[model samples]
Target: MKKRNQYSAEFKAKVVLEVLREEATVNEIASKYGIHPVMVNRWKQEFVDRASEVFKKGPSEAEKALEKEQQHVAELERKVGQLTYEVDWLKKKSDEILNRKRP
Candidate 1:
């Protein structure tokens, strides 16, 4: 069995950009990169299809999820702080009561 080749995002982008430029045939690009022509074509198609995503305004889904997660963590941290303070107060009061009873 042979392992599959992995191409980086930068390399794929370069190849796709070259294809978009129409400076050479897809076959030529594929041979130069030592990859299959179909692979090159697939990358080109995917790049063209998703190019609009680069221009879209507003936060992406991943960013929104990250923000929501950060808020949740902050809320949890605040609750923990409040609980810790309450526990410390309760312990101090209990110690005072115990000391009073001993006198």
Candidate 2:
């Protein structure tokens, strides 16, 4: 049985970057790296797809800050609900004690 090849993230990134340069053909790059041509082509396409996102301003600093703030609000809301439940329980016990003293 032939052993399957395993590649690290760094190695895949390097291969994708090399292909993005467009200076070398996929076949040539594959030959130099001893990887399959189809694998090199797939990496090249993936790099192209992700490279566009880097240039776009979709995930800006403001968006990240807003996300953090929303998460904090959610946590605070949960705490408030827990405290409210506890207060209601205590109020019910207090009412019961006062009624017993009257009787």
Candidate 3:
């Protein structure tokens, strides 16, 4: 099976912008870019949809919330790792003390 081609955001934007320019047909653009017309159309639609956010005053509420959630998850992961190390160290120390007492 052949893997699908992946274009970078910048390249997608460039192609989408060309389509929006009305100078060339979508088929022409797709053929030039070596991509499918359907893919080109999809990129153009995404470009149009996201274009509004570019003019918005600030980050959207959802974006801010998502960033906050990611940070919180990272902090929790750090704490979990620290606690796991501490628990492992305590178990080892306790086993050492128990062995000493047996002798």
The candidate that achieves the highest TM-score relative to the unseen native structure: 3
Please report, as a residue range, the 10-residue window in candidate 2 with the lowest summed lDDT: 52-61
For residues 5-31, what per-residue lDDT tens digits would candidate 1 score against the true structure?
888999999999998899999999999
- Per-residue CA lDDT of model 2 for 38-71, tens digit only, reads 9988877777777766787677777889999999
Model 3 weakest 10-residue run by lDDT: 45-54
The TM-score measured for candidate 1 stands at 0.65
The candidate, 2 or 3, that scores higher on TM-score is 3
Give the C-alpha miss distance for residue 96 in model 1, angstroms.
12
TM-score of each model, paired residue for residue: 0.65, 0.47, 0.68
Worst 10 residues of 1 by lDDT: 53-62
Instruction: Indicate which candidate wins on lDDT.
Output: 1
Tell me the lDDT of model 2 at 26.
Answer: 88
Give me the displacement of residue 14 in model 2, in angstroms: 1.0
- Total backbone collisions for each predicted model: 0, 0, 0
Runs with alpha carbons beyond 4 Å of true place in candidate 3? 81-103
